[model samples]
Target: MSSRQRGNFNYKLAFKLFSSFFFLSAIMDVLAEANGIFALNLLKTLGKDNSKNVFFSPMSMSCALAMVYMGAKGNTAAQMAQVLSFNKSGGGGDIHQGFQSLLTEVNKTGTQYLLRMANRLFGEKSCDFLSSFRDSCQKFYQAEMEELDFISAVEKSRKHINTWVAEKTEGKIAELLSPGSVDPLTRLVLVNAVYFKGNWNEQFDKENTEERLFKVSKNEEKPVQMMFKQSTFKKTYIGEIFTQILVLPYVGKELNMIIMLPDETTDLRTVEKELTYEKFVEWTRLDMMDEEEVEVSLPRFKLEESYDMESVLCSLGMTDAFELGKADFSGMSQTDLSLSKVVHKSFVEVNEEGTEAAAATAAIMMMRCARFFPRFCADHPFLFFIQHSKTNGILFCGRFSSP
Candidate 1:
């Protein structure tokens, strides 16, 4: 009640707020690094064939796995923490809190764009999962643990989960889990869905879009509807990889599509081989890009892709989580549980107006879990990413190698 006491109290409150902000910022940086590393790793894994196109939301996949990581214990938790880059972000509660903060920021209301992310846990009605685990998921990830009758109604449970994912993603993603993906052995399933729609700050004139030749490779070519625009945009060049970097801002500027186009003489594989988390950070730094009026030509394309993430995560060193004997998820329940499957599906459409993208990821424990732009010109194959400017988090990323 005293003046000095009041002053001290105010100072303490301010300091606490500052500390919290700093902590959250550090966590975001760690997450961004993790996302970048994982994105490149996934690209390399899925892009073994240079002739195919690869697309998915790294954020969606990470969010789904982080929920499973919440229940993981011992080696299962350790491997997941390492693979998901939670270990570098201080691990344990910090990782969850980081995601909580991130989800809050990305899903903020009143933004000019539409970006929503939702998480949920569908557990077998008969299983006795720990109350602490359920509470923590709800508290830190805004994910509710829902009880489902996976034992007797396998097909119904699958449809229910798919329906939820479809609803969350505005119907952009449906049937995330196919008919047999879940069965009587399934006990728990963790799901995460993200949807985003935004308009370009400087929309390309629709009339300017024309059918153009897209060089798929030295010996292959396809016709694509190439959108064209000349505007002032952030552009950079990476001589090390013979790549051109361009930033295409969406309306409100909170999100942007970044494109990396390698010179025709250099194969995209070369650029992929040289990409690392550190290099990605350096290459995409705002300071490294300059704003200038340039002609941009990007193809209007739509991609709907699906992946079985069990093998992908396993190859990335997340083995114990899938191994029933070795897996440890004591924090979730006393039940001897192991991940059975991880299914992910994503849809994205890029056009003269802007972009709409949605992705859903499900970890069926049984359970387990689981662009720009620059278009100086994109007549050749290139890599692109839709990134959150504030947190530097990659929302969706892929290689547009084919039409």
Candidate 2:
């Protein structure tokens, strides 16, 4: 319950947090355009039918353009919702460059994740998807570099990015970034926000999981299966949410895979929806329970996914942000400018006790599928997810039935 409220609160918080970073004009234009491109890519990946998922909030595959361009030159995040127009860059940086760079990065990281995951899990499917996205993403990034202003461009990108990510993620990830979230001692704080989630092709067994009473909320208790497992892991019990979060560290401790199991009567999906970066971080710092009784369910599932946002933006009428001829970036440099790319990457895998996921955003083009009825006899509801402890990002979201 608290997590949900917090998630709702973060929506406004995201707007306020990065609002001050850049001038209104700069932030609005760049972020809006980038978000559109992001949406377009989704059409490319999942197809037009899935538009509702990428367009709306909560369960939406969406993003905001936010970043701080820091080059030897000065930078700025303009105020105002609509983007300001700039002189055509004979070759100078363009409005789209920042978003292009952002998308490019998103696509690059997403591809890397898909490839690595395919090699380990998906195999041939990974190769298939990679082949499809490679050309598109590269072309997008190449386009962004056509006009580049290192510093100002970064500022325009970063300003709204933090806010965009914070809003999309529901604050599960306060800072959608790593060491750079709080850039050194510099007065300027540049944050990159990332929110991603996916469901399994298979789900865990609800019947197989032991159903027992759980301490759901501060005021309630109900029957719930506390998924159990004996594994070397990290976990935290959140008093606010009345749940215990278990962290299953991935290959490189840098990416932490986690699970949120509510006290009895608590809804896993409810808890999942309410997750935030602030709350997630708090969960991680918790003291570990080396050995304890837990109710666990194993789900048989897998998820295949990817996205692009160019067309979505075009639909929004931010044409100038994507093209060199149409884009505007004159404010940054005295010369011409054009967007290179705006990229984003996301991945998640889920099982009974928890999940594993990773996400990144760049300005290059970035980029997913699904279905199955199993013959297994496992009957019951199971829980699973992949969460980024640092940013509270849900890579994949799902529930399993073992009936």
Candidate 3:
């Protein structure tokens, strides 16, 4: 080919690649937004009881349900999409591809932290699932549909699934499927597990740790081991809500913890009620935060929480997917399947060194941080989030109210 012809071909190739890159980035952004919206919604639902600690992995739950959504049709698919904030114009394919890219990006190797997200489908051995559905799951979500004899060995099947979840979460989450969670009617189960262990970019000195009183409410207080450190970190204050926002980076800086602490006089409910996807994005924008030397005092705490999400999802306008006759997962199979249950369990521990969090979410379908030189002390009820800086995805989020 002549030099001019070769130049034209190369230019076209570059343009095509650029367009593909832009498309992928846009999809990721959409996925992130969807996650944020779902996360906040779930928080609102789970936070109704302000007396206890609430912690869970929205990422794990979203991915697991997305796998089910891959095969959902009609109203089932539409409800799932709306609840998940995945009503993008690109349709289901776009959502799946976006997750495909996200899973790959999050699980990429050679990072300073150990972060892994995995998915799998467990179906009754006798059920006949469409090959297209299986192929799409594997192709888009890297999830394989495994066959189990749910009819003959109900307990065995449950144990097998729990074992898989435990293995995926490095044993942090065992017994994800408790006794009787799977029975003869249980035809399918979809599971997603996320595990993360990372050290802080600036570790807190153990010697500086001291017992501090954490205010649960105006009338209640409890003693906690507060970890302290003085370092440079991104910090900001939302005067409108009387909240302080701080970012605490993990070792790699790719992952960070964001803490939102309402003023001592301000009720956490005030901030929670005002939280929205747009406001969260604006509050945490890089430009909105400033890096400065801060004295951080965060309590050393651990939380393990579980939820049966059928009612929760239903409350969020996802009733059709969980309904018996109304559910339509035709894209998966013609077996008239409906989601039977969605169970999620999460564990997290934060110390002077860093943080370790593991969560597993199973969809049993039956036919179904920083700092604050200004002294950012999380001595009261506050919210926290572990986010993937690169994708702006919320990996885990919770509220530490009692402890």
Candidate 4:
């Protein structure tokens, strides 16, 4: 197949694998509307052309990381030019070719970041999708490194990812990714594409942002400039653990974020681990955060992060694509060879206007909430979980967001 065809095939393979681990049945109670919407949004942001079901673009990647589908254009041709200017901190993008050459170079250059792609390919399922995309990919990744400190192969991957992100968001997003994750000895680079865009969903009317007494946990309350918004929203419920959910949308109606809190006390820190699509659905039903006259106050902040997937992917059970001695990467090298390496990273940010959310969630919401007997107020630190329902795994299980 042609290079673009190969890239497309690889992306599909990876996505399908990503889907299996995530939500294989969108309508079978396996995926939530948020995940479905996010999936569609991702395709729309990347390139959704019905004609070219399998075409390569700046918005597609062969494989890597937590199987998080940050973004992709189904069939439309990717706009390579637009990626140069988007300065939006919450998004990222990339594109690359010559899978074999790149992997070889990364292995030679990234000498200090080995052990990054730990388990490699344990519960891999993208084997088929990648083949359809005409690309070969597997998970073997870890967190990203700081810029200015990137090794050659890592820098190259960053270049491609940023290129796509900048072009896609019209420079609204910047290059916030690096590669110092694995050892240089096994730093194998591969062809791939990835992007993340987290803008403000509610967009705390910056003009209306006010300093409110932000209750942390039991006895901690700090005056924080909280962003406030009033709107009819989608809801979810967590059982007795304590909390209700609010699904807010952004400008395009393609992306969103889920916020959860306890019923009586917003002890966010204690319940971060229990937040998920299933739990949210359960919590929203049992607990109601949207009480009558329920005015919501949130924060306004943005975190643009990029990390290597080598380690995390392995941790999630994907281990076969990185073994140079036992790998089967002839598709990339055109020769009998062991799998070299695969590096994948992404960028994401959560802001006030809305959330330009990207890939992955790490269950870590730590806060406390204070509420009265019958009122449902999420005004405290409660578990904040971000899930990709597709994989049923939390892409972002943290405890923070702004108005």
Which has the greatest TM-score?
3
lDDT of 1 by residue, 114-219 (tens): 7757567788888788999889888877788898898899999999999899988889888788889889988777666666677887777688899999999899
TM-score of each: 0.92, 0.34, 0.93, 0.47
Query: Where is the poorest 10-residue window by lDDT in model 4?
Result: 358-367
Q: What is the C-alpha lDDT of each candidate?
A: 0.83, 0.34, 0.85, 0.37
Which of the predicted structures, 2 or 3, would earn the higher TM-score when compared with the native?
Answer: 3
* Clashes, model 2: 126
Q: Higher-lDDT candidate among 3 and 4?
A: 3
Model 3 C-alpha lDDT per residue in residues 1-403, reported as the tens digit of each score: 9999999999999999999999999999999999999999999999998887989889878988999998998888889999998896445588889888998888888998876665788988787899999998889887888989999999988998889889888898888888988899987776666666777877776777999999999999999999987666899999999999999888768999999999999999999999998999999987768987677899998888888888889999999887778999888888877776688888887887743330011011101132224788999999999999999999998999997
RMSD of each: 9.0, 20.0, 8.2, 17.0
Badly placed stretches (over 4 Å) of model 1 are: 354-375
What TM-score does candidate 4 reach? Answer: 0.47
In the range 1-403, model 2's lDDT, one tens digit per residue, is 5998989899878877676434333533444333333332332333333112221211123222321121112122221022222121111243434435434433345321221110000111111222322333234333111111223344444434444545544454333333332221122221222333333212233334576543333454455443333222455567776676655554433344455556555544455445543444455553544433222343333332223334554554445544544444333333333333333333333445222332221101122112231111112222344433333333333333221
Cα displacement (angstroms), candidate 4, residue 11, comes to 35
Worst 10 residues of 2 by lDDT: 117-126
RMSD of 4: 17.0
